[model samples]
Target chain A: MNDARRHHDMGGLEAGAIDRGEHDKAPWEKRVDALMVLLGQRKILCVDELRRGIEELGADAYERYGYYERWMASMTNILLEKKIIEVGELGARMAEIESGRREALR
Target chain B: MSRHEHTGGPAHAHGHDGYDADPTHRHPPRPDLEDTPLAYHQVMQMAVVSLLVEKGVVSADDMRAQIERMDALTPARGARLVARAWVDGGFRERLLADSKAAAAELGIDLGPIPILVMENTPETHNLVVCTLCSCYPRFLLGLPPDWYKSRSYRSRAVREPRRVLAEFGTDLDPDSRIRVHDSTADMRYMILPMRPAGTEGMSEEALARLVTRDSLIGVAVPRAG
Candidate 1:
């Protein structure tokens, strides 16, 4: 056994009973899943790259974020790391959408 | 017959239609972001998608098509494969040898990822778990269930499988051995459960009805019609 196993690598450990409950995926989550596949198809980001990004998320974020949320975090980092999208560009886009949403609400 | 040839919808449609009585528990309510603000990652996703489309990295139509393709894939594809394997010995061999290739022969694109089909016999049962992250056979089975990605399932499935199976209401014979396959980075796994008895002489489509998603995951054996 590796002495320093990553937090996401939780194979054999004591845990609570399984939650058998299921939920229909939200539209946003589906979009996340689709974008992931699409990114792979475009050779922009590979599964391994996304996976490595996720593996590096420390124990705190790994447990806190939802599954697709973690994926979103990973892909966002990968895109930025590859210089596909810059930090300012991502921030500006997000702000534009947020203000647009707010305007629609008003 | 192509096993699942005639279908406007699945022969055995599952209920999560909000009408199903889940007396025990229900998924947490999703906040109406209209009244509130979207989560950070939700905003990030929107921004990313917009940027991608604007950059011409991928078109909006490509996203729609990919999402539709993913949703269209369910356990039915796996069910169809199991039915074909049951009726055709050669297919069974090919399926066991290389599931992605076998699926491709049936026009199912399992992407480029390699998937291994584990066959369940009289004396053996197989279970799959991705202890790291949920590396499911997403192309074949669609998105994995939430429980599969849960910390409890990931931690316990590799060590206490039979007990977990019991939680899923599956109790195999004590004599039969259980083999747990931890899905790694490269390969994914799906189980080929043994056919239920007295289902002889049935059409492939009819046989496919007996093969449920849980059966494909080796959680429960199918019931004969």
Candidate 2:
């Protein structure tokens, strides 16, 4: 189905209880949000393009991810689509960062 | 009835046996990443930002300035606007007519996105939601609350708006019509909730204190002092 009819089309659906809890903004989430806005201001990407990238996330990821997590994933996809970064390079850098984080935790 | 007819769209034709049922549908996992499932995506975001800086797509200062700008905004600006609108009838007319210009009159630059002010009246209550994604009036109200972005709120707001409003502790009269505005496009929305009674002589500053962030989102009403 097209975007207009996808699962994200939640305008009128039966849903469970609303969780009104507020969480402190995580540092990484803030950075990602700022980065996306910065990129948009520079005309490197537009809001519609970003929205499209977000909507393109497959059904499972869309359901499982948090708001900023979805933003991060969409930004990554947009950068890759625009050829600002290669897929292989992104994977390698992500692996390096992940390993570094694990080391610090240990 | 056909599956499409039952679900109201072709998207749900696959029913429960679709995407989630596929054994290989998982995103490639990174064991070294933070233990939470979301951690991998966060790391990938950092990687993307690093690559953008390295490639000279945007400068470090640009990122810093953007972050600072976002940090500087708060819902206090929106609260002040609502308070001013309550006290001055002419200003309230302007706010209802042209929200962006009215916001500018009070020194709030709403950026490029058009903001429409929805007035909550006795006969009709207003609620805002972005069912597609969490589109909000960020320029006026700062970042939206977490629950505003939750799937439950997004989905249920349009289907059962009265129930949702009641959950927010905003019990409307049974006869009051509920108008749910979905921010699907470029235009963002903010609610100018009806000013509470018993605050007739209250100063605008004092009235501003009564406007909560949830009230601006139309989930609740400004409290009486």
Candidate 3:
């Protein structure tokens, strides 16, 4: 982690190959993108807050996820921080969905 | 009783969710979860949006409208502007003077983000990068390509612009200075690449076809064919 510059700062760092292939956006990714724009347009959250949330993601998660994944994580964290949704509720809902998927698989 | 296995073998005989019996059983890598159709982060995003809707933070209609608005924008708008500027010197002057107004004249809505048109001359080549983040003129050019947001492009574009441009197959004169614009502020930048040689009589519409998205981003120039 280059602490001298912020985590989001990527200027002048050595990085790997640039994948130029264009892939279609997944459905969930599209919805998440729209949700972010809607939230911004409605004044529910600002771009700066979103950027800060993304920047605050620990080094591990930051390097692990893709661009949209980071955005989704940042938006989720911001919502949780603002008390829009409780952590327990979010976790329970996720678990419920996971079990539902397991049931479908079985 | 490992967290991972349930067959009741010696791995599960101790009944501690199988993890304790095998200290080597590390948590599944996180990237695997993202490969699934509905990634965990996507689910979390859905949950957050659902809760926000239920709490009256934003309506479903608002989201739909925003999605529609984004869908309506594409790089063709930028192509049209570049093509027009190429055929008309006066329009090019106006475009460089006030990009927003020029875009408006060409029926392109640039949204709230201010756009600055950086012309690429023989003496100076222009490249755009948001060193702080992936900030491009989305209103006109649409969402940036994956490489534009990559850590490599963002970092290398500003540090060694000529080398970066070379990677994109855009080799410039060694003596021509390269100006890398780090779009760290509210304003977004677009490169107005010089028109390629030949086809002097080509229509503006025909010329627009040569203006690839990469050219608008300054990674490559508009090719003539």
The candidate maximizing DockQ is 1
How many Å off is the CA of A87 in candidate 2?
1.6
Please identify which of the two predictions, 1 or 2, would achieve the higher DockQ against the true structure.
1
> lDDT by residue for model 3 over B71-161, one digit each (tens)?
6778888999999999999999999999989988987888898899999999989999988878899998877876788777887888888
- Candidate 1's residue-wise lDDT over B1-225, tens digit each? 111112112212233322233433365323224344567788899999999899999889998899899889898989999999999999999999988888889998877778889999999999999998888887788889888888998999999999999999999899999999998778988899898999999999999999988888877888897
Cα error of candidate 3 at position B77, Å: 0.9
Query: Compared with the true structure, what per-residue lDDT tens digits does model 1 show for residues A1-106?
Result: 5768888888889898887777666567788999999999889999888989987777777777778888999999999999999999999999998888778768
* Candidate 3 pairs with clashing backbones: B1-B12, B1-B15, B1-B17, B1-B18, B2-B17, B2-B18, B3-B17
- Candidate 3 at A37: error in angstroms? 1.0
Runs of candidate 2 exceeding 4 Å displacement: A1-4, B1-38
**Poorest stretch of ten by lDDT in candidate 3 chain B:** B1-10
Each candidate's interface RMSD (Å, one decimal) is 6.9, 8.8, 8.0
- lDDT by residue for model 2 (B3-59), tens: 111112122212131123233434211122233233666778778888888989887
- Candidate 1 chain B: minimum summed lDDT over ten consecutive residues — where? B1-10
lDDT-better candidate, 1 vs 2 = 1
Candidate 3 lDDT tens digits, A1-106 = 4557776787888876565654334345567888888878777778889888888986666667767778888888887888878999888877777677666656
Best-to-worst ranking by lDDT? 1, 2, 3
User: What clash count does candidate 1 reach?
Assistant: 0
Which candidate achieves the best lDDT against the true structure? 1
